[model samples]
Target chain A: MRNMIVASTSTLYGGGYLEYLTPFLSKRLKAASIKELLFIPFARPGGISHDDYTSKVRAVFQTMHVNVKGIHEFEDPIKAIQDAQGIFTGGGNTFQLIKMLHDLQLVEPLRKVIYQGVFYLGTSAGSNICGLNIRTTNDMPVVQPSSFKATGALAYNINPHYQDPIEGDQHMGETREQRINEFHIYNHIPVIGLREGSFIDVQGTTEILKGTLKARLFQAGKAPMEIEPETDFATLNLNH
Target chain B: MRNMIVASTSTLYGGGYLEYLTPFLSKRLKAASIKELLFIPFARPGGISHDDYTSKVRAVFQTMHVNVKGIHEFEDPIKAIQDAQGIFTGGGNTFQLIKMLHDLQLVEPLRKVIYQGVFYLGTSAGSNICGLNIRTTNDMPVVQPSSFKATGALAYNINPHYQDPIEGDQHMGETREQRINEFHIYNHIPVIGLREGSFIDVQGTTEILKGTLKARLFQAGKAPMEIEPETDFATLNLNH
Candidate 1:
């Protein structure tokens, strides 16, 4: 049985880091009897040091009486994932995270433990690794990874922090929708545009859309459709 | 001698496609005595077909009595670049364009022609390839290319369509400046953030910043600086 919390953003507007998801996240940790979380800080938000990033998460999880440790501290990262009670990959740069994961040869080990049910939690760049491939990420290519292949924990790709076109904005850059649409030109995988504060609560084979915001779903050769909150993604034919 | 016009965008606010650039573009073609232009439509903005994208450019250039032909129309694309009097590459998806260019092994041929004094023009994704690499691109990682290396025609990378943080915006996604700073974390290469309406005129050994807006210069471990219009980029000690 797989258990996952794939979030669009770690922190919401006017909220502290992970403040909005604290209640639900605390409940999940307690339900799973998880006391310690192995945090993957490879994404390195703002290029903060591993210890600094880990401490940030530690401060939040400490409120729930759960200890947080960064994987970088472990001698054998593969063993750390294999032994962790729960895992949380914080968001930053997807390219940087993927590059390190691939360089350390942790993708396979991480995938194995997740399938065995290690309680995976990911936000932004973290959530991106759960997809079939990171071909839908909105992050810049800050670095080159060995490949775009992700953990494949989920069958589809995730577009986190997905924003709609700004009404009457003068910018010439492509909108989030247009970028995802361009992805469809070369890839056939389904993509879910998770707006800020939105997430997917995955338990076993059932995946439910959480939060108040609606998600946009784009499939190959089909017009994007809006998915309401509380909708079970597992019910949809995502294989297309 | 290299003669090229690398623009941040093809169209500007409240302007038609290439309308803002038409006057300057017309003068350049006439000065070069270029009657026929070779167009590279591989960027495929909005996923438009090559023929359709080429037609759009053709419609505008026809006003100047200049003929435009897509490289795809030629049997030997390498030879097409080698024989063209002038070339224009429209913007779309940088990764897709790089993938095709690499897949077809046209990078060398394109570079050879450009260094040989073939008048070249590029916009958005097109202009991105003229840099040292495509790592600074704002485009989504919709596809995985064999490599992030580009034409290396320019000494530094270009962050096209560079925009400042929207004042008081609620979006949690990284702003263009933050994104570029993150890029500097993993890369030592200098990056020039070209704002909309800006173009870098590369004539011989000098690259001058054109247009009304100021470009942002980012170097490793240094605060980003503002570059005014008509500033020569070659004068900057970018090696630092």
Candidate 2:
């Protein structure tokens, strides 16, 4: 089956962008395993141009002189994705990313690419779309949607950069945990609270956590559990 | 004129259980000369019975020997609200509060009470429904509704407990401001980021800021502004 490596952030710079799959990306690229990198730039900040937003990936690929293309430029993106060697979706607004994907009917094709084991890598919004719904998202409902459904890549939703409630403040706002719990009241999907500098590496069905802190797993009506790196997440039995 | 005070917290205790409403609710209740406090227990935590929730509120009121009534038992809540000396809404799940209000057709009646100068008080979810839409709420979209509209009590939306993004996290989640900004793009309503310990005191035609920090205002296609507590919120034209 096609493998998916979903990260909270890109691990290129000192930025603790959830340093997952750096070794994998490097090894895969060095061995000439993938002929090209198809960059999905829909999550670009403020929906900027693909060239401007995908520059970081382009720069990284330039070091290896690997072929790269931003699928946003294509008039027929579904076919473009179908013909791609591998896919990497950068982070930005998940709502915008999903909006564009649904608008262009690329969700199914992208899903097919992942299921085909065509080397799929996702960051932030990219990672969020891999889940059942954007309910775990820290993003605001900036736009209305036909639905909150996503790719259903995982049984649990993803809350990237999950932070506990601040210790001392008078704000009456609900904490991230509280918000996610509310999401559970109406949703059966479990949630994965991925902090900064953490990620999930899925190689053929095996998910390896990579980061300093353990990821928090939240199932409906159950207390969250912290899982360290090397923990096999697939065995969580999140479906129950 | 109906005096509406959307508090940040309850004033029953030392105000530590809830911390945001010191100035807003405390000052308004004092000014309204409200010795009697009628509590609305529909948003009780743990889904407690209306009688149980009401008894707890009455118990709390007994300490001060202040008259307290649970509006949940009233067949004509609107009439009860119209005749009440003061109505105080404690906070819980905003979805629950909204659902009950809509089911009971009390939104407009509550609005009417506020207009009648009944000295209305609310915290968290209670204050959230006071806006035109709960889009600015910190609550998760636990369930979808036919619409995202609310009471339209204020000219703008309220994002209580606004916090700045962490300085050093590689997590790719959107910040609180970014989320509300997204809401602005999809909806035209102005959003006010009311930090903890901050609130607006609505007395008759005057809505004054009564808190320690400046409230962040977000509008579509415009830069957000942080208005201080002393700013004349009533005079600010938000017609656009």
Candidate 3:
């Protein structure tokens, strides 16, 4: 079975990094019998180095009795993913992550291992790759990737850290909703706007919403609506 | 003379399209003795069609006694830029605009004409092209251009619709400043954050801030600071 926890963010405001996710992680990691994970730190939030980011993630997973290893630690990244008991892609700039993935020629190999039922955890930019493409990401294009194509881990796309337009807001920049509407003009993939603390719990062909908050769903030629917690996203007809 | 008005936005809040720019347009269009201008509506704001978007801009330019013709109306787009007495690129999605520019093989041609002393008016996405690239745009990657490369009419980049972090805001999405800072991690190009109504008035090599507001300037490894209105941007030492 495909077991995954694609979260919107690694940290919640006013909470320690991955603190809010402890309960879920403990249960999921134990269920999968995964005591170690291969971490992809290529996203490099705030330009953090791979070793430093790996250490940071190590500190958190250590609290859960899980060992974490950065992919950069291995001489061959493809081999690292193949040998890992589980995989976790952390949050950061999506462009940077995808660029490094493509540069290392790791996209196909990583996708292959994930489908073989290796446990996977993705937060923020990590969650974005679980979708069809990174086109819907809220992050800036600080770096250009080989393509916007992301891992087809899920049938639809993900817009993490999704925000609603503020009432009486005057900023003329297109709001997240308007941007998604424009995406529909050229694409048909449904997009899930996962608010902070929200995530999709994926197992095999089933994907369910978690973290209590209602998630917003946007598909081409249709009005956006809220998907309550525990709703199966597959029922949204997110198929291409 | 590289006469140009690279504006932050096409319309100010609570104002009609291009209404707030009439005073500047009246003087500039008259000074150039230009009665007709070529419009590139490829940006296609709100997914607006070239014909409809052209009509909207034409109505505004008519009020200034200048006729507006969309590049789409021409069988030969490169020739349109070469033959035009002046040029105006309306505001819209920067990715959409630049993608179309590259797709039509118009970047170098437009750049050549602009440097050849053709008066140019660029609002929002239009203004962004005058910069080095579209890395700093606030628009989503609703579309991916062949490349992020822009016309380099200016030494730096432009972050149109620049916004500051709201006090007491709890959203964890990176602020405008933070995003630019991350950009500096991989890029050294200085970026000008043009607030609504702010613009750069370029004459030959002289680029001065206009629209009665202080613009924010971000440079690699330097603290962001405000540039007062009437200040020339060249003094910012924006060399790559």
- The C-alpha interface RMSD of every prediction is 0.7, 4.0, 0.9
lDDT of 3: 0.90
Model 2, A144-193: lDDT tens per residue?
55566788776567887777677774444567787777677667888888
Measured with C-alpha atoms, the lDDT of residue A61 in candidate 3 is: 92
- Candidate chain B TM-scores, in order: 0.98, 0.86, 0.98
Candidates' chain A TM-scores = 0.99, 0.91, 0.98
A1-240: candidate 1 lDDT, tens digit per residue? 889999999999999999999999999999999999999999998899999999999999999999999999999999999999999999999999999999999998988888898899999999999998888888889999999999999989999999999999999999999999999988999999999999999998888999999999999999899999999888998756
Top candidate (lDDT): 1
The per-residue C-alpha lDDT of model 3 at residue B216 equals 95
User: What Cα-based lDDT does every candidate model obtain?
Assistant: 0.93, 0.72, 0.90
Clashing pairs in 1: none
RMSD of candidate 2 to the truth, in angstroms, is 4.2
Global lDDT of model 1 = 0.93
User: Whose DockQ is higher: candidate 2's or candidate 3's?
Assistant: 3
Please report, as a residue range, the 10-residue window in candidate 1 chain A with the lowest summed lDDT. Answer: A231-240
In model 2, state the lDDT of residue B51: 80
After superposing candidate 1, which stretches have Cα over 4 Å from the reference? Answer: none
Per-residue lDDT value at B15 in model 3: 91
lDDT string, candidate 3, A12-51, tens digits: 8899999999998889999888899999999999989999
